[model samples]
Target: MYTLLSGLYKYMFQKDEYCILILGLDNAGKTTFLEQSKTRFHKNYKGMSLSKITTTVGLNIGTVDVGKARLMFWDLGGQEELQSLWDKYYAECHGVIYVIDSTDEERLSESKRAFEKMVTSEALDGVPILVLANKQDVETCLSIPDIKTAFSDCTSKIGRRDCLTQACSALTG
Candidate 1:
């Protein structure tokens, strides 16, 4: 009875290993989004009241399962020092999810640079990228067309496919 209950509980919630890579520039809500998406709200965290999360480390893996698919969320290291390691797992991923803090105008250049690096890399050359123009709920979030244009142009710079990027709250299943 205990084993069955535990299994049911995990499945009912979110946990899995589909290997989804979340890439973006630093402080792009990459970590906080992962935290909130996986678990519920907590009162102890500093930004819990303001609705934000602290910085993330070099690398982290967050899991969320939908249906029978296990989503192994890979939160890559956003720092200049750690980004060199991104190639190690890029090939291992089935898909890519690029998160952009549309509200952060200052980081746009970094975002473009990072994205160019991704599409030009050997590992992610053909993998379909899902860009989350996140923080759209915010007043300054970039328009979907603008974000898509940025992404499309980056892919063009890297000579990769310019598939229409979609605005996703979360990629389910």
Candidate 2:
């Protein structure tokens, strides 16, 4: 009887875990987004002060419980060299959040290239992608339409998967 009751208790409390990857070019606000999410979703979680956040040299991990689901976020570093390591986590991720620094027009093409490569990987086939045009609060940031236009070519490579593009100021939201 005790064994059966313990099993029931475990089943009742276990959560469905989903692993999400937060990826983008350096300074694209991936970490900020993660911090904000944790603060919002997990009551009593005192996240780091956003102003003092620094470049993620490797990765940062955070978890939030929503309903019966637990979301695990892996915020990866976006440096050119670090990008090569992104694929190592692809197979395990349930979804990908690709952040683009809309205010940095000069690096837009480079960001697109990286994004194209990520979506084409067979490991990420059919994985849902959330494209965030970050830094929208900046005066000169690109609009969602502009970002969509710039990344139009990648649509074909994205395959038949759930994809969305939205403007977000990670720092402010």
Candidate 3:
């Protein structure tokens, strides 16, 4: 059974569609990240204006094909009121990209709480998580290591799940 399941997983990953959720607190750069990703992955893609990107009231969906993998991304709104809608997409997401506004020290605690809540969900078990410490281009932005330390508990809660935390500038990408 284990071998069969492993084979099925490999086959699906190699030939089927995959979904990724881009989640974070409001103004944490989720939409910017999605736009950047689209610009980078899609050929001749005319990306959105970073300066004009506004808060996401609901969700922004994007798709890109890289090699044989057709990736569908759900960039969900991160407002406190919209967080309830996040879990609805979790069960179908193959991976998660959790963004954080590295320059907003004031909301670090709130972000941490939200991250902890997401990572603890049973639906996300064994899913790979990429925590992007965004807004690094800001002069006052926290360093990647500092951001990681701030969410140490959240990462620890992702037990046995593959997770990577990195600093990035969504605006510059």
Candidate 4:
């Protein structure tokens, strides 16, 4: 009875916590998305200047509370060298948000390769994936359907894991 009451109390009073990883190729707006989420979900958050935000060499951590849940975001560096370190965090994350530069046609293939590698990792086998086709504010950006089509094979490779692809402008949001 004591254990049951304690569990109930914890569930009712403590916020559920989840860890999410933000990943993408270089200049794909991962950091911008983190900052935008913080600014939108956190009260009194004085976010940094988007223009001043440079390439992330390491990880930038952010936290936000929504409803009864607390979400912790790990925005990792997207450089080719940094990608080797992503698997280290795969076991600890509950979900992944992969950002893509919709306007960069040249890097789409490279991004697809990296994304396929990540999604197929045994450590991340069942994790949910949220692919953000960023830079939608640009006139030349690819549409959501086009982006989906480009990554369809990679998405299929994820097996039974939940995956969603959405269009977004991290800079504007």
TM-score of 2: 0.97
Winning candidate number (lDDT): 2
The parts of candidate 3 lying over 4 Å away from their true place are 1-15
Per-prediction backbone clash count:
4, 0, 0, 0
Misplaced by over 4 Å in model 4 are: 1-12
Residue 99 C-alpha lDDT in model 2 = 98
Q: How close is candidate 1 to the true structure, as a TM-score?
A: 0.73
Model 1 misplaced regions, further than 4 Å: 1-16, 40-52, 157-164, 168-173
Q: Give lDDT tens digits, candidate 2, residues 30-142.
A: 99999999999978999999999999999999999999999999999999999999999999999999999999999999999999999999999999999999999999889
Superposing all C-alpha atoms, what RMSD in Å does each candidate have to the true structure?
6.0, 0.8, 5.8, 2.5
Please provide TM-scores, in order, for all candidate models, with all chains considered together.
0.73, 0.97, 0.89, 0.92
* Cα-based lDDT at residue 19, candidate 4: 98
- Compared with the true structure, all predictions reach lDDT values of 0.71, 0.95, 0.92, 0.94
Weakest 10 consecutive residues of candidate 4 by summed lDDT: 147-156
Clashes of 4: 0
> Candidate 1: deviation at residue 112, Å?
0.4
lDDT tens readout by residue for model 1, 1-173: 99999999987874455688888877777776676666633334333322444566677777666666777889986776777778889878988878887888788878888878877888777777777777766666788888766666675654555444555443220
